[model samples]
Target chain A: MNEVPHLMEHIDFDTTFLVFDLLAVFMFAASGALTAIRKKYDFIGVFMLSFVSGLGGGLIRDAIFIQAGPPKAVTDSKYLLVILGAFVLSLIFHGSMHRLKRTVILVDALGLGAYGVVGAEAALQEGLVPLAAVLVGIFNACGAGLIRDVLIREEPIIFKPGQFYAAAAILGCGIFVGMVELGHADHTLAAILATLTVFLMRILSIYFDWQTRPVLDEDDRS
Target chain B: MNEVPHLMEHIDFDTTFLVFDLLAVFMFAASGALTAIRKKYDFIGVFMLSFVSGLGGGLIRDAIFIQAGPPKAVTDSKYLLVILGAFVLSLIFHGSMHRLKRTVILVDALGLGAYGVVGAEAALQEGLVPLAAVLVGIFNACGAGLIRDVLIREEPIIFKPGQFYAAAAILGCGIFVGMVELGHADHTLAAILATLTVFLMRILSIYFDWQTRPVLDEDDRS
Candidate 1:
């Protein structure tokens, strides 16, 4: 009985998990800010992208679930600070980051892994069912990127010819749920397993040049 | 006493509103399609801009109020059909609307008014207080356009030096509630008054070069 209460409290204030989530958000925000900077987006656009890329997914998920408040990106000042930091950093190193294609892709893969794991973890913690958790996780991982693409008036990456991006997120979420079921809910193990699963899938897809066929609707079918 | 239910049911299925809302959505979708074509956006971008501009505001309002699925646009197939019609029309007369700057703004203002009224009425019906209702209405009216702006990576008209676009929306909605409270619940009269109010405000602003003051952080600090 005592152990149950302790576990509940542990879930409430897990400093390690919180720090891990923040790190994931920071990585995602940095990538988004860098992309906006490269596109020559003005200050407001860059700020908006940085904020959205860090928080858009979570906001969508929370809104869908009817969770109260404005999501973490709005509620937590620290997240905002981190995004600002990333934006400033991106501005300083824009030339180098823009030049190295390999480094950029690597950072993107890391961001994908981190966001995927964190999203799945949030869903599970919120007591969502496994299937819903996976779906939410996928959205959490990709929603910001989708918004980024749409704002740039580009076709979303999901609809583009590319390596399996969404599939990696889904895989990571699935692995996370499986690990939790097997009682490996420790912070380090969860992060490592989920990140590796997504990162490997993304890398393999890039290596093999895997792509999903686009849905083509004939003109004037309407 | 029994007349209350009959009134509620009548208002719930007000056919005049149904027609006006559809017309407004069609007009706005037409503008979005034209913009997309002018920008030479791909099929997805064109389709997305049209969809977002048509439905984005209502969706935002509904989400803010924690209302249930699909909102107005998603629930009605006519909204989709209207957008498709607009897209087809744009393709046919692609060069024509591009040169008619004054005509474009007039049509856009009409659409904004119509959508703003719908948003205000919906919020009132949903039991939001007057202040909240007006806010919701403004959000619904401008949310789609804001999304369009963000997607196009332009400074949103709201954040730019412009006439009080959002303020106009709020004024329309405020009048709508006041009129309804004064027993002007007749759909046609309410719609006409509210829409005219917004349209005139928009026109006056444009003519006079009316604009909101910008927020200067340095000035504030001083």
Candidate 2:
């Protein structure tokens, strides 16, 4: 009876996916806008960074798969709306928000975790192999940060010694794969576990002051 | 009698195609390194900008075609050597070189032209459709600049209104397509003519201060 579709049936939207997607969008957009403000860039610059940081991972994934102009950036304008919304909100609360660095980091971790799971699940849905799915997840989580740093004129944080950002994404992806294999096919459970795993790892790494070594030494410069 | 591959190839080494490639490497590397220095970025930033500005177009084209990492960046290390050499040269003449902005623009135009032809030819070699090949050519010319601008924390010159940068690439690519259709299949002749076309177009556009409209207006700002 569940398989049957009626002409008059009211569609029930999936609330779980909606929540995580909105959370990820908000987190990334906030971080990106703040970074732009710190750099003293113009409004357009702020908008550009926010857009790239939020959509860059998905853009890279879709382009790699030859999807051309990824739907997240092209078809849907919600991402843009979210970016504009964040920009306005940030501008309004710019002074008060400057002291929320700790909060920003936590939200960033949440966004990273959510995006990792979303990217991995999206890849799996596309019938990608597990190895490829893991790669996609890693690319999704850290790829946007790389683009953001590059845009902000900072050395990309990924290649510099870091707190295993990619590693966290990989772990979350592995957990999702494991859950799928264990008959836990529910999207809600998979997303929560993956997101929590990444968030915990990131928070622990930050709390411990884990960081990567700078690639350049005194000798290299001279 | 002239079909022998084992015969001395040195006689044709000085042909237009070889010369164009050499000039392109020199000019593109200089432009890339100069941007890095101007941004006051560290050594890694310098190397990254130089490499991307020199080889980024090819990399993007290869990625689009799903050929994985671009061969130009990998097959030969000459590209790296050229960029490094340019960096060293820039350091040596740093003060005097800043005044050579006009010269840099001219050389950049040449690089743009050569890269456009090379990209179109490469796409044709890959059997891509004509429109795709032209697009690849444009990407090859403009991509490096976009990457450079992004790394230096500037709005990409492409998105900013001014100087038909992409338009020149498009025109050069269109000319290459027309020439190939006209049976001018000799590599040297085609490359030289196409390069000159793009270079002249770019120079004229810049001299005349041609520009485009901004993607977003102030009113559009949130």
Candidate 3:
């Protein structure tokens, strides 16, 4: 905290990363809106879900872990605009959302990977320890889904026995940090490789219907 | 953000306030543990609920809105120790929690008010505008219950069709912030008045079973 105000002066992010982050947010908002529609929620619910899906993880990451000035979501107007746009489009095409499920899932994997890298970068830039950065990265990637599930009264994917969702981000972020800190790799290269790993793992898991057993499920049954 | 560093250097809090904050956290943690046990959760569940209930709102406030250093909950190990102590005590007295319901509620009201004031003060300390500090105060008072309910697959009390829970916090926080900012009152006097407001509101609401309706519930039904 003592050093937080000092670090704020040094915060600098490039345009390319910003664009990718916005794209990820847009995709997540769209998915969230579709879920809200499926749940029979009203326009407000649609906006809420969209907002949470788009920025929830980053919200948690920046506020709790980064302790950077106000969360970027609130400080930057662009984030809200992107989320609103997604909510509107999702509602307009609510009837056709079912048809676009595959497309949404495809882009979602990409968004998750991008967010994983972006969140990790924020933490690393904050001078967080490597492990903390990884955890923050995972939070940035999956916290939205967790919050949305709780709101909808369904078990979060991370807590449920499911394919590797958070696990994908965990590996991607861990490797990204490891690469920079241990392997002495370029940031750009590490981000790309880490994102690809998450994207591929997500795609493969979907195709194979890979199942993660609940940690206690086997023991309980036995 | 530019002035944040300067503000940090000037930040100071007294010991009496610190003690009260810890006591509030402990009470909240004890209630969370009871809820976990009632839900048939294991010891880990007890600890998780206790942690979330004890500090979830402060976590959200400090991280998301306050932009202060890492949340006081994390920065201060005493908070964790208090939560752990509550968790252990609750577990040991698990079978008798039901008998202590009336006493717990009485003290819980006190904690809610204390947390409300503490949260508002933190936001105020960070130089949040009056309205924002009030909002943060309400979050501090009841955000834990909302999160815990969501985790347990129950509708949050704030969203339900009964009680003046969040409303109580809102009024108290609003008055506290208003008194300090508009009335030019002393901080200690303002804080005490605000906490008393919350406590009285809670007690009166519970005694009379005061209820608030969902804004849309009546509209849709009508």
Which of the numbered candidates is closest to the native, going by highest DockQ?
3
TM-score of model 1 (first chain only): 0.78
Clashes of 3: 1
Output the lDDT of residue A186, model 2.
55
RMSD of 1: 10.0
- Which one wins by lDDT: 2 or 3? 3
Per-model TM-score, in order, reads 0.53, 0.53, 0.58
Flag regions of model 2 displaced more than 4 Å.
Answer: A1-59, A62-180, A184-222, B1-18, B41-48, B63-70, B174-193, B215-222
Which residue pairs of candidate 2 clash? A161-A212, A162-A212
**lDDT of candidate 1 at residue A196, scale 0 to 100:** 83
How many angstroms is residue A88 displaced in model 1 relative to the true structure, after the best TM-score fit? 23
Interface RMSD of each: 8.5, 8.8, 6.3
Which of the two candidates, 1 or 3, achieves a greater TM-score against the reference? 3
Candidate 1 C-alpha lDDT tens digits along A108-205? 78767777767666766666555445555666777777777876676566534356787677678778766665555654466567878888888888
**In candidate 1 chain A, what residue range of length 10 has the lowest lDDT sum?**
A213-222
What lDDT does each candidate get? 0.68, 0.68, 0.78
lDDT of 1: 0.68
lDDT of 3 by residue, A1-222 (tens): 112234344443366579878998888788777776665555545655677688788788887788768777755668777887998898777665678779878888887888888988899889999898898889988888888787767767688778888888899999899988887776776777898999999999999999888667645866
- Model no. 2, DockQ: 0.06
Tell me how candidate 2 scores on lDDT. Answer: 0.68
